[model samples]
Target: MTVSDQENLLHTSSYYAASANDKSMRSELIGEQSCDVCIVGAGFTGISTALHLAEQGLSVIVVEGSRIGFGASGRNGGQLVNSYSRDIDFIKHHYGDVVGEQMAAMAFEGQRIIRERVATYQIDCDLKEGAIFAACNNKQFNELKEKKALWEAHGHDQLTLLSASSIQEHIGTGRYAGGLLDHWGGHVHPLNLVLGEAKAFESLGGVIYEASEVTKVTEGEVCQVTTAKGVVSAKQVVVAGNAYLTGILPDVEKKAMPCGTQVIATEPLTPEQQQAILPSDHCVEDCNYLLDYYRLSGDGRLIYGGGTTYGAREPDRVESLIVPKMLKTFPALQGVKIDYAWTGNFLLTLRRLPQVGRIGKNLYYAQGYSGHGVTSTHLMGKVLADALQGDTERFDVFAGLPQYPFPGGRMLRVPYTAVGAAYYAFRDKLGI
Candidate 1:
């Protein structure tokens, strides 16, 4: 398909794209321009950084390959689940307590930042509260209790444990044994949220150019980023492309692999049907290596998502691939008709914790959010801006964390990670 044809295809295929709030098309970068910071990629990290820095009176220019929120930021599962992709215990075990505790303190900061921005900017993204972590079996249910305690020990007290008998109170389906409800966790129209943020950034005097893909970067005290139609010279450059940052920065690319996840939205359900699926209207994600997360759209459609493509390629018949998992979660919806199906890629790191730091003290970058980009990206956006402003205390904590490239390098990392995912899937299946 042609570029326009592909974008049209994606726009029609994703529920978010179809339902996004209307916004003016931004102009593409046309000529050489100078700024305090020139960011490549207008996704959450880039846009959020632009807004933060603009608040501090920095001249910011954002260059996006496509329109804002065109990537995973606009098309994710929409569940605002807190914490990093990897739990804090893992960081504490592998790293030391000081680093682990420091990371833990910032676990829920992303959600707070998002909420603050939305209310301050008067964003209307159909924001809702509460999220449920459904347990698949007894082992997982017990683990939920432990998770609550662990998070409580780390200053998170908004969690409530539910027993199997009370599971139906939160979810309509009988698939879950029990779950932990996070009062702070919630869902939203992701595209609307980002679009609103972009508007907010513009209101703060930040410049944004869409359809401007960065082609080359000349690193120095003054970084020069060459796009297809323009060159942006700035004192600092922030590479916030995440998984889509392929080939632009090989150093950041080496530490992560791109993986695609699929999501499908059903036709608007009857009010009764909507109530029958999710009684509390809270987003639900199961506890599994390869888990299923689903929520009800503001218009009453069941938006269910799961299944990962390890090689970062789109799955054939995306609806067919995701429907079975949806049925397994809600058998009552086995015959429900799906209205939209789409796939988006996320950067997955070996340790699953996001990698945030500067490249040679001039080029700043943050990626490898795994599946936790929704909340983590916002936190990193602020962290990126703060570090650029010379407040490096919080940024230094993440930068100090160890990073390693995938063992097989570019040639075999995909297959290697795929094999590792398969092994973990087997373990999750056997409850080992």
Candidate 2:
């Protein structure tokens, strides 16, 4: 199918919308506006930052091109797994033990912040505990074991190493050789989390305007963001648009590329079938470079996610591609029906680290979480807010990392990324 057709096919099947607690429609930006901070993109990064700023008693205005939670933040697999694409060894090798330890400690803090906010705000997002990193081969199993040791050495005691038998006991899948369980990392309804945070921000006297496509961003003493129907001039501007961020900032667009990931949810399983498939109700992700992440929803639906498209378009048969992978993990679900399918874009940077830094003296931007945005984005929001309030220590650590621009310009970026991803896909297939 074409890109537009794929987007339409996928977006129409959001389980979160049917069960979302907050369904109120926010007003679009239609007039002149000004605030202390003007945020672009209303996904987790934007909403979380706005909420943090509002809590600090700062005037904040968020302008979203589409509705809130319409981006990856709303459509992800909802796995709140810790750690980024790069491993702890990578950080230690590049940034020394002291900084690396600090970064590792900060990584787990994201999960803590999410749990605290959920309770403090009383947001109902179907929060759950436990996440498993299942290994597809012995090599990956050894890697997980090494990671468990490393995490323990770094003062993280929440991770438990599970042997093959123990892994089967938890996931009911014999395909994995072994796994690691993180009690702190779990799942939640992503849309509800974003919307709940948006409500909390509004309650704190923050302004949010949807359908406000930012067309022009002119930087000056006070950066001006121009939407089709409104304009926002603020002392500070934050470009939290991630992959969907286009035209607002060319420099950020150059540093990261958008890749599409798809997901499908099966019809509710019988209690017997659900118990057979996943007894513990924990999120599961394999250790492949092109990985498969899945979880059983609160309503007993099997939410499976896999198969990425490097280009803008999604696959013609997303359900067909992903269902086979899901069935491989649980062959008993041979005749299960797929009830929903969707796709969303995620931002990836060359460094595989989140890019957080200031554009000018007052203008800042944060994006490129590389598929670990759910928890990291929330932590980033706090860091960004603290920076705006003159606490730059934590934010500077992330900004100190290096990032490479996409080799080709916008016209050739998709094709270039396709070539690069093809290499990784081949490697994953070979288990290299």
Candidate 3:
């Protein structure tokens, strides 16, 4: 199937969509529009940037290809954890201690930003506290130990180490040896968060249009963004589309490869079963490259996600594959039926670092947060908005990270990534 078809399939199944607070009646772009800043993609990155810019008194316009929160922002595992995909040691060794220290500070700050937004905006998105990184083996256990130490070295005291027995008490699963729990890291109903930000942006006088796919972009002193029905000419354009950003910006797409990840939600569990599965209501993730991440929803459902496909295509047996994985974690759920199965695309960069930089003079883009976009995307929105407002210090810090073009361009890169992902899947199976 084509990318468009795949996106249509993926966006149509999210459980969050079924329970959204309000259905977006936003219209498509029409005629001509003008704003100080025009943002592409109405997911977290775009809406957050619009909200920040509008708060700064800038005339901001956002054009989303579909309804608000239809992208990975809304359809993710919703684990708002602090920590980048890249390790702190990697940052320290490559960028020196000073830069690494700054990045470390920003890591925790990302978590704080999400909490502040939820509280400030009074977003009732089923916010929960605490998250755990469960280790399946000794290597992962050691990694968690080092991570706990690293957090303490950075003056973060919210992380606690749980032994195997304690982990079982917290997560009912004996598959993990031990884990690191963070009080600061938590989960939220991501779709509601995105919608809350959208409403906040509107309240701050921002303009947002749905079903407005940018077909062409003309760059010059002022950038011209042409959608299906309208053109937005602005002094600056921010591309925050992540993996689903098709042809709007070729330069941005080259550095990040889109991969489809599947998720499934089981029928609501009884209170007894919910407590048996995740007693503490904390989100949990394993320590593999292709890891299982699951959490209990506010409605007592088990929302589990894993299994990645390189290309933008839905898995053949989303529920069939994931139901077993979910059962593996909780054998007691052998009879629990899956209520929903869905998929979404997330961008993966060559360096595994987020790609944030300027294209030409006034065109800015940010993508490739890997799977760590939940909190990082919010931080990125503030950074991009600050850069647009002439404070490029923080934004430039991340923009300095290097990104490489996919080896074989758009068409061949899918298969190329498939080959690479197969290797990682093998490693994950081998527990390496």
Among these predictions, the greatest TM-score belongs to 1
All predictions: root-mean-square deviation over Cα? Answer: 1.6, 2.7, 2.3
Cα deviation of 95, candidate 1, in Å: 0.8
Whole-model alpha-carbon lDDT for candidate 2? 0.86
Give the clash count for model 1: 0
lDDT winner: 1
lDDT by residue (tens digit), candidate 3, 8-84 = 43346778988888685687799999989999998989988888899889999998887788878989999987878
Stretches of candidate 1 off by over 4 Å are 1-12
Per-residue error at 70 for model 3, in Å?
Answer: 1.2
lDDT of 2 by residue, 289-322 (tens): 8899999888999999987787447778788789
> If scored against the real structure, what TM-score would every candidate get?
0.97, 0.95, 0.95
lDDT per residue (tens digit) for residues 1-432 in model 1: 378734732343588888888556888899889999999988899999999999999999999887888888988999999999888898899998998999999999999999999999999898989999998888899999989998999999899898887879878877878999999999999989999999999998899998787888878989999987789999999999998886888977898989999999999999888878788999999998888999999999999899889758988888888999988777888788999999999889988888887877689888899999989989999998999999999999999988889988988898998888799788778876
> What TM-score would you give candidate 1 relative to the actual structure?
0.97
Question: Using alpha carbons, what is the TM-score of model 3?
Answer: 0.95
RMSD of 2: 2.7
